[model samples]
Target: MSETSDSRAQRLAAESLAAGSPTAWFETLYDAAGRGAAEIPWDRGAPHPLLAEWLVQHAGEAAGADRTAVVPGTGPGHDAELLAALHFRTTAFDVSPTAIERVRAAHPDSAVDYRVADLFALPPQWRGAFDLVVEVMTVQSMPRTVRAAATAAIRSLVAPRGVLLVIGGVLPADPDPDYGPPWRLTHAEIEAFAADDLALEALDHGPDGLRYRAEFRRSRLLADTTSAIERTPC
Candidate 1:
């Protein structure tokens, strides 16, 4: 029996994770998708509704020419384009070269700076650099083994007084490693985003408490230099 495209993604992610290369399957997935053998399942073709609502709700706070935003693991850039529309100097990055390439191709006239970047090995200048970080559905897609580090990396992207919004599936119980390329996150895992200088300002649960939209804000009182980077793995 031939594996479906979705199943192929799961298999690729599983194999890469087992081999201790948690993010390597991203390139493989995009490469296959680029070759017309697969689909980017997470690409919603528009900004996520929850994110769109959040932006609308915070229009006063989010709209500004001086503001900067970044969407790490930005798959097809719907969210990035939305942010760019709001006058932010937005940057959307993905670890997969193929994914970035396709995004650039899809939006040749886009104002967004779509580039290739690894969350684990981000440029030093990017730390605490953005005025806003919209991290929807990115961290939860990673395995729990690296979930903490990934959360920290996302948290680190926000500038002092900035916001980090995380949207993802909520794990009702203990995370099962064998279940997903997009492994769901526990309450504790979600709380991890509030670590260090950030505080949980808002949390909204979706139907059956299976989805969540969490907002975290970093303290403006903190200096640019970080006291701790929270490099620990999940």
Candidate 2:
């Protein structure tokens, strides 16, 4: 016997709530998403509002640059599409083959290139290739031990004069040691995480100053002029 629409919906919702971590949920989604699932709840359907707003505000500045944007952990490609629409040559990746397949099918003609790449195992050819590195709720999904490695991988993607934008959510309190794949990063912790060669350009914590947007710019490249200037030995 076939199930009713409402019954199927109810069953899926129940399964999701019981899934616990978002990562586990993604695994479930990968299996169920098929070749082309129209509506995944985590999709958010449209472009990310914060990113869209920034693109609109910076349209003029971005238009003149030849920049490549990399979206790590791009599940269903909403954010990648948004970046491409804004004129950035964007590429997005996820470890899940199913998720990558869905994204590629959805935007077949788009400039966005959806590839399957593990966060840490990015192709060497892509190293230092992006002018913009985006981490949208991706890093927090990892265990604490690998967080540093994840941060390092993101940093490596940015060119000397590039930027990194990380959008992460917050938990009610400190995340329970038992509950995760959606770790909450404190503002201080984030600052420390990206402290070495990147500096915060703009950080908005919003009303509560926790769940937020953090933008980091790679330290300015030391130009060849430094050697030229040193010849004078003043």
Candidate 3:
């Protein structure tokens, strides 16, 4: 009998964990999916509901006619497609080459630029270039030790006055030890994302207390001040 997709994913996840790479499984899974040997469990085939609602609420305001959005860990580009629909010049990137190809193939006419890139080593020009950065379940999928770096990297993608929307599993008040390939995030972990330049706007949990949605906004005032400082005479 042939090994099933779920089983393959499980095996890959185990290998990733054992290797301590934390992100290796992403490429492995995508490679399997590309070969029609495995299925991507999180490929919902549409933009996440939270993302859709966010776009509608800030339709004309936050996501104006000419803005840029980046979707990291863009599995099949569903969320990226939605952002493009709202007129944002969207860039969707995945660490897996095959994932990028799959999304591009799926949306042949899409204006969204799909690329293969790693979150940790993102193109320098992309730093603070996006008006909106959407990260859905990507950080939690990484190993615990690298989660902070991943969060910081995600934050770096947001430009001045930009918004970051994160959706992921949250660790329960009473945590479980055997918890994850989808590692659960804690309240402190989420709150720590806010800093001198970033501010937390909201943090809400799903009805069942299994998942959370966090919103952060970069300080436009700070950005402007920094720009002025850079332009000032020595």
Candidate 4:
């Protein structure tokens, strides 16, 4: 008996699964999408505008002069580069192996450490090692069912007395609900979550008013806490 093409394909798919691959279809999609070729849709071809704006505003103002910054779902590593340039020790990660490899390739001399790591299943060693956690459009890219978990994981990465910088788009007053991949984060929603364990330091206009730039500080209290309300706060 000889194996047919169909049988071979099945075998390969089964092997990939047995090897703990992401999804069987991932390779095919990446192949057609030119995964490592650069110019990915999520890539802005430079550091995100919101990230740049925040760095400019607080590059030297953060209380702790020496702290580690981590960028989850770091695509082309532009934001990580910006953090490193600002003198913070930086680590950037992406779930996609191709994306992580691309980051390293695109920035061979970058001071940041680029790694392949899932946002939800971060390595236990990194549980609370970062003083700054930067999340840019990552939660939106995930399934809605996992958004809360995604938010928790991101929050968990922040060290005590650290900050979380979130840059995302706004939802319509009455959104269609499913029209997302750019999931809108309502202001109320942000406050609700951040209030649970973090303090809202700033929720200002990002590069553009349409997109928001939010900065949160981890609460000092073991119990629930909230930051001072600020309409024009930092």
Candidate 5:
């Protein structure tokens, strides 16, 4: 019997997870998307509500103009485009070259810079480079062990006094290992970003209770404190 699409995706996800390279399936999915074979479930064709709201609330702020923003794992670039619409210097990257190509093809005149980049191996200059960093549904797609690294990478993109916004699916306090692809993050995992000078400003669950949006801020004082502690010698 032929396998169904859902089953195929599940099998592929399991295989990728077991191989400890969950992002490998993203290339397959993007290739399929390019061929019009599979739809990317999270490509909403518009910015997510949390992102939209953030833009609305912050766009009028004094420093909003000329702000640098990045969207890591930007699959199709809707959120990146939204940032550009607000006049941010936006850079959007995806691990899949095909996905980056599709987004560029879809929006030829877009101001957002769309490129292929692995989160774990981003350019050295990208460290602490953005005034705003948005990660949507990217980290949860990876295997559990990789989530910490991914989260740290996401955290590293925020410059001092900048902000990080995260939107992803979340598990209940107690979660089952087998429940994934949209792997569910635990509260502890979400809170972990607060380490190393970043501060968790807000964490809110979606109305459906299956997803969450977290905001982290990098403050100058916190960065200085961390630097002082590091200099003090353990």
Candidate 6:
């Protein structure tokens, strides 16, 4: 039998990890999918349910005239499209140029500003720039070596009083070293988003107990000990 998409993703991730470029395989995955050699395992063709519900609950506060939101690792652009439909000035990005190109092609007249950007080296103006950020499954995709950097990048996306929402599978305290391209997040890892000036406002477990939804907010009033990183420019 030919290689399945899941197996292909795993093989690519393993190869990329060994090469010291953990995220490099994402481009290859999208490229193969475009050529019909593979499918993207995570392209569910709908907004993630947990993220959709959160947006519904906050609908009144969610839409705004000049407010902006960002979605990282927006593979097929579902969540980003939904945010745009709800009237947010949304920017969505993926490191893979093929993925970015595909999402753009998928929505030629879309309001979302789709870009190819690496989360690790985002533009300096992005620091504390967005009024809201919805990150789903992105951080859990990173290896442990980049966990701090990943959380910091996510944290820096929110402006003061802005919100950061996360949704991901819950991993046990310790897991097998070879577990995933999505290396499911530990509770401590999720809590790291609150380490800087961001406050953990809500944390809920999905009914199945396998998933987590977390909400964080940066206080409009700066904390006395807040570092420049927390004050956040680049």
* Strongest candidate by TM-score: 6
lDDT of 1 at 232: 12
Count the clashes in each prediction: 0, 0, 0, 0, 0, 0
The TM-score that candidate 2 achieves is 0.75
Residue-level lDDT of model 5, residues 117-157, one tens digit each, is 99889999999999999988888887777889998999999
Ranking by lDDT: 6, 1, 3, 5, 4, 2
lDDT of 4 by residue, 79-158 (tens): 88888887788899887676676678778889898988877679998987899889887775554555677778888888
* TM-score rank order: 6, 1, 5, 3, 4, 2
225, model 4: CA deviation in Å?
7.7
What residue pairs clash in candidate 4, if any at all?
none
* Worst-scoring 10-residue span by lDDT in model 6: 225-234
Task: Tally clashes: model 5.
Answer: 0
Q: Give TM per candidate.
A: 0.90, 0.75, 0.87, 0.77, 0.87, 0.91
**Tens digits of per-residue lDDT for model 6, 1-234:** 888877888889989999999799999999988998889998889998888887778877677558999999999999999989888899999999999999999999999999999999999999999998999999888788888898899898998889899888879656795678788887678778885678776777877777888878888433422221211010
Model 2 gets an lDDT of 0.67
> Model 2 misses residue 119 by how many Å?
0.6
Which residue ranges in model 2 land beyond 4 Å of their true spot?
A: 1-28, 35-41, 193-196, 208-210, 221-234
Cα RMSDs, all models: 5.8, 9.4, 7.8, 7.9, 6.5, 5.7
Higher lDDT: candidate 1 or 6? 6
Better of 1 and 5 by TM-score: 1
